[model samples]
Target: MTRLTAALVILGLVILVTWALWQRSTAAEARADLAEQRLAESQQREAQHQMIIDSLWDNARRQANQRRALAKQQAALTRIASNRLATIEELQRENQALRAWAGTRLPDAVIRLRKRPAVTGAGAYHQSVRDPQPLQPARE
Candidate 1:
């Protein structure tokens, strides 16, 4: 083949190879961009999941603290009640009049008060606590 013709063929082959390399570079860049986008999305999802987990942990911690506080309060109240009962029993033992009074039947009003269902909530407690008759008027 003529040198000029061989050179033209070589130049064409060079152009073809350069074009193919450019196409491959662009494709690689597109894949890299897509990978970066997917990575960003995954990181966002992970962050949201971590936030939810942290919130749940915080809530659990708060509830545990509340339960501990409630248990401590209950223990204190139980101790107070026991002490009061002991004092009353001691007094009852020491005094014949008090023992006789304790043995007497409770008043109907007192029995009704004791038998009433426990009230719940602020509104209900307020309503329940209001005395219908603060004091019995002196009989005419």
Candidate 2:
């Protein structure tokens, strides 16, 4: 009976030691996999940010081209151009922030949030706001 009890105790100890060693080896692999996952997620975030910046750039470019084509021919469009310029500046600022984010490896934290414009109607012209002629009443 004493021999049997001692054998059971030895068997339990052996099993516990084996389990501990196995856990240590598996933990290292899990840590490596976690690092790889973090890298992949970072890359994906950068790609998404790049796409957003590209879209904003396209919108700003289109607005500039339209402003050029209109070229003081229409008073409403010129006001719209001013609004567009404001909008473009906002976009450029945000774009620069995103560029900085991408240039640095995606940090775990963002220092500052980007500011966005709050203009209505997508920067289209309103008859009321004549920027250059603000001193006088708007001409029909």
lDDT accuracy of residue 91 in candidate 2 = 75
Q: Residue 117 in candidate 1 has what lDDT? A: 60
Q: What TM-score, over all chains together, does every model reach?
A: 0.73, 0.38
Alpha carbon deviation, residue 126, candidate 2 (Å): 18
Across 55-85, the per-residue lDDT of candidate 2 in tens digits comes to: 9999999999998777756877788899998
Clashing pairs in 2: none
Q: Model 2 reaches what TM-score against the true structure?
A: 0.38
- RMSD (CA, angstroms), candidate 1: 4.0
Off by over 4 Å in 2: 1-21, 72-140
lDDT by residue for model 1 over 19-105, one digit each (tens)?
A: 999999999999999999999999999999999999999999999999999999999999999999999999999999999999999
The TM-score obtained by model 1 is 0.73
Q: What lDDT is reached at residue 128 by model 2?
A: 28
